[model samples]
Target: MSLGAFFLICAMPLLSGCAGFGGNEAPPPRPIVTAPPIAVQPPPAAQQPTGVARDPSKFFTPAQMAGRPLIRVAILLPFNSPRADIRSLSNALYNAAQLALFEFNNPDILLMPKATGSAMLAQKAAQDAIREGADLILGPLFAEEVGAIAPIAHASNVPVVAFSSDTKVAGNGVYLLSFPPDEDVNRIVDFAVLRSMTKFAALYPQDDYGNRVRASFEKAVADHGSQIVTSASYPPNTEGMNLPVQRVASYGGRHGALLAKRSELKKAGDAAGLKAIENSDTLGDLGYQAIFVPEGGTRLRALAPLLPYYDVDPRKVKFLGTGLWDDPSLAREPALEGGWFPAPPPEAHAQFVERYRRVYGAEPPRIASLAYDGVSLAVALSAHAEGERFTTEALTHPDGFAGVDGIFRFLPDGRTERGLAVLEMHPTGAIVIDPAPVSFGVPPAL
Candidate 1:
């Protein structure tokens, strides 16, 4: 099996493929959009302080937009790779940009190509478009491809809005429009702290996705004054019962890795060994009351039952996860009775699904939502960023625009301020348990 499969197998339990929700709630006739919206709650308070006030003049002064030339914008995505769902991705990006453009009625905005199918092709395409007087570029979706072109675009001073979740590679003019699971992990820890669930124990796969989320969760927890009592990482792929069983025996001890005291590092070998097992629990032991899992929907279902085997009662412990667990399968899993995961409102997703089906016959894929949001956001910027200079003043206007994802605005630092809702998973299905909007504080003074 592949490394991804290997890691996932070790970290999660075996389960059948997810079946649709088992409820009388008909999949709410597909929305005109790909997914329907969750029942709308009262909109959260607007104008809440972003915690950081930005000096808008630094990025976009009034003098910038004046008399700038109109420039074309290029959007490139792999629409031909053998393994990729090119048509769906391309259509979602195209449709989203088109939808936003239609509302703005701007003639300067131009969509570059139908789509590029490979990284090499996308790089060449972007270069060609830039030479052809394209002012700004949008997309080149995959992370590896984005890394390949970001430097090229940065050198040319052309901004790109890429649908890549790897924040480590994003820089100067390249804004990531994709949502990283790491960000969700940070948000989950923040919410966990607010609820006074401090001691955390993590069991995550040792891979890029899992490691990224683990780091963010640890950072957030520490910042919030909570402690990570124990954190045990499993190899990316594990099979049979031996792996988890052994991991439990090795890492769940009173003097396990997590319980080792940092202050005792200078001691002799005897002290170090002793510290490693301090405050640790026995095998199949759960040392913390809260567990933050960063996993895909399928993996989450597999890991659910193991919590109890490790002496962690799912009902008693607060389980936190990301939008990855937004699927109905999570709610239906008996072992995931009290899990809480963050997700965009269901009604909103339903509506988008309906719209996508109406436009293209089938449901929009999950990743397609990011493509849609990315292009729509870029189109919003293009509508007003006329002439030669893409004015920061226009992009960060006091009155921000709403997009398919949510109400949002662009920060001068190239980060986006998004409004997201948290969903709670029940045995039957998920409900929008928390109505509060997570505010990405405003851009810091730059």
Candidate 2:
């Protein structure tokens, strides 16, 4: 498909069905020219259906008025969920969206913040939105929640920009405004290849998240004309990481080689050579030149030091990681001091954080920036479109958008493509070694 067409995946064939919720109990969304409003919860999850989408106007049916017409944008999230941790993240995102709306100060749009306590609630909320005459939809944070909202929104022909990262829930008229690991790995691998680090390896965790990361990493490596010399997985815990580390270092094979070298030196009675061999570490070259650790936070902190201890020293093998490495606390970890990872340019996000803190009176979560970007994109599109906005063509603009992170746009496959940078972990802090792309571009495929 063409680049522009590739972005409007919803325009192609209709293949999606999303569930939803509706109720007067939802937080009423006010207009931005009057912006409206966080909360926390935990994580757990996980599906969806397929069908042709219906015309949006058939259900939206908002009557035309003077000046800029007021459009209703639904903001579905689990504001009152059971998990406080998840609630915090979702609330931060909601606040970020509110911040964007406040900044936009666009009197033309009325944002509706609906508390989607569950899939059933989300489904009802969406159905209620259809009845209320919504022109657009902003989110339903979780994948299943997005599914609940989809069928109602699509059948009504209303366009949705869901915050869920699960690509499986994307399709029909729904667009995912999430940073999936697939894009993260693809961008990092591209950066790795550009650094001339061809040989690759991955130390993965034994979990579904790790599975996705592994698949993305493999495809990215292959696409860049590189190969994974070693790939191994370990349990989620800190202990027993040895097997994966040893496999990557080729510990058994190298030990055998070391013994053979020692035998040769001993047989020849070369005292100086024997001494040098004894003092030197294991075989320096383990084939792969770079190793990717698809982990982050304390788990990553625990896993990184093991590489060198297991003989895969930074001096020999370059350590790589995903965007998960973009954490302030990580700078304190000496083991990750020389590692590299992919993320959006930090300076832009720093500006966002400062503004968010000032407005919200507290620091927002890292992922919350996405909500700001998503809402900002909505505002940008709806500002002067005269209701023509939110269409596939308008939503999938080729220029993409300049958000808190960087440039990003939608794809025909119902996925988001973001321009990311290659960051280097240092003792001081993580710095952008490579800036995100200034323009939109497709990621290379395997």
Candidate 3:
């Protein structure tokens, strides 16, 4: 099938079923199309523009406004960010949004791309978008940028569906669509608790992400009637990890106890006690039944093995993680095998990745799905009556919208609650052990 036709078929369910929501009820599940394989070559470097091009003509064409009522949705991003990585992310987000628009075939929705490389620039972008009669704003992908534009968008009463994971900027008409660590922590902890794991520990980094996850982890454990027996904080990098890992394992105390026991056995002439202590490095049970490791990538690799190395045996104490542990490569780490983490269901996301690769000829960043879903949401809501398309009430429907990442809905406070699945790490890859719910209303507890 043609690529355009495939997307059109995939988009029908969302466009038709997402129009109306009465009262505070869950919406019916919308069917999603799984695209077949398509052959396409990769795009060249020139196709990925690094420099900012604010030309209005690039996004808005005369043919798009063929007498239909327009819904201006402005997307503010760091198109000219000094950091090349940020700039590339901005381009990917823009491309994803454009792809969503094209797939849904929403001609009346004019996507206005604005550069927000700095707070001042983001404020100006917000002003320009509001001046251009934008009904809704999509992003300014940083916390500072979101803060800069919040008042302007609020004054204009243009609702913003931003992409920042920081919950601090997620209120007063600014909804965050990005994946917050709280959701991951809550889901995994809930799953652990359901499986009868009571006491827990954590090994986290000393950074903003770590702090956020730590807070969520504590609350989740407490709410599930479980206790946090111990936790250790380490530097964000590989350095300074040994002390913290050892601390969590109580290595010094446990080893000291082992030596003391061995000496006592020798003095008392108890051969069995001596034999038990002869080979054992530690002599005490861990206080916790499970340990939460919220680090990922290199830091995760460095941190995970230390637990087992320090005698916090994975067989005795479960290893838990947040969405940061969603990497398939982490499965190769022996310490992470049988470890569990929470993430969005992979079925629809796999299809999204395939489609994106076919079209863009590159792997879309993990967060790129946010832009596609944000645009899909705007398109779905555009089918509503004029002046009611982007209201807070309309946006916060209890029955959330289904997207490539699965089911998600915005709260009145602007925080997004997502349906996450629990996955176990195996030598081959991560496998979904618990499926994500198709609809909302399920409590986090068993």
Candidate 4:
């Protein structure tokens, strides 16, 4: 199975670091969203960066290193895996990091190749990266690998910036860099609530990814004081899809009997009756103005029509989805029309895109830029601090950093507070019909 498909079945358990924050009641009072300063744009082309400015903490702060010493960064990835896509993604991320380093006087970042397609190989690679004197460890990519390496990294006190979102496996110095599935639902729920979507219905896969998304969506809905009229889970397959779609779409308390009613229709009348029944089973009403779908785009395409089938007009009901909905195929899917989700919109990184293409001979993928930002930001912190300890003070500085992606600053919990744009998949194969209001400040300190 593809890594994306497999991630659905086996996901790493998340470790919650509540930081003694209060109960899940209302999220603490949020700062007003305002227009970011125009300087939020990319760095000026003419402004010659001092080496210290390249990574401020690395030089400026008493705790971080200065002058771009050979930053021995070790990239840990599942390179030997059968899934070439993830391998390619890893390569892209590595290339992006390298490019970032080159801009900062080309530090001595190394890729510690591992034979991690199998369980045994992953262990060997994890040990090897540490042995090689890695200052900052990039990844072991998968959740299982992260779990295996967490203790080792903790023991070594080598800061690991990971690609996996499974926070449970992330050790003290390990910072998860992958977009959390819960954050996806949170953004959608927040947007829907802003637009006044009071009732919600969800149909998701019967797996961990789906479960994580469902839990987040449920919590968001409840937190917003909205009701979830119907929520169901189905196996991530075609046959498993139609039933739930029919159930959630069915009108007037006749959710489970669509198939039975179809059987009762005479052969001559069945064709016409099936059409009518399908239509009846598909449409939702005014009260159900939002649908949260956490499944991947392929399955959602098949299920999308069922939204209209139940009477939920795609135009009327605000469709919410996960970060996986960023797939380009979503544009071609008729059911995804009017859908919105939170993601690092590529348009925001125009300069990064051009530069990456110039360097890598291809457009940078989502995670590639993210990994680049992680390394670049780390270097920035290292430069700013002018020491090797990498204190928390170095990380949360508000000098307003810029990278291949847009401006972002670090939060206390090691999560990046980035400005995410809410993009819509238009019928014309375009996205980002309406952008969310950008928050200029650091995201509530995590």
Per-model TM against the reference: 0.69, 0.82, 0.84, 0.72
- Clashes by residue pair, model 3: none
lDDT for 405 (candidate 1): 52
Residue range 1-446, candidate 4, lDDT tens digits: 42212211221110011122346644223222222111122222322111111232331211233343544566676666678897677667667766656544424333233335444455555555556555567776788877666666666656677777765665466666667776667777887888878899888788878777777788988999999988777887777776787666655445446545776775557787777766455222455778788866567777777667666677777778877887777788776777888876555355555556755568887667766666665555444323543554554444334554444544556555555667888767547755643334423443
Winner on TM-score (2 vs 3) = 3
Per-residue lDDT over 163-249 for candidate 2, one digit per residue giving the tens place of the 0 to 100 score: 888888888888888788998898878877888999988899998789999988888888888899888999977777878888877
Name the top lDDT candidate. 3
| Candidate 2: worst-modelled 10 consecutive residues by lDDT | 12-21
Question: Which 10 consecutive residues of model 3 have the lowest summed lDDT?
Answer: 42-51
Measured with C-alpha atoms, the lDDT of residue 29 in candidate 2 is 39
Clashes of 3: 0
> Where does candidate 4 have its weakest 10-residue lDDT segment?
10-19
Q: Which stretches of candidate 1 lie above 4 Å from their native place?
A: 1-71, 84-108, 114-118, 236-242, 245-285, 392-401, 436-446
- Where does model 4 exceed 4 Å of error? 1-68, 107-115, 118-120, 251-286, 385-389, 396-402, 407-417, 433-446
- In model 1, state the lDDT of residue 169: 55
> Is 1 or 2 the stronger prediction by lDDT?
2
Which sequence of candidate numbers ranks them by lDDT, best first? 3, 2, 4, 1
- Error in Å for residue 400 of model 4: 7.3
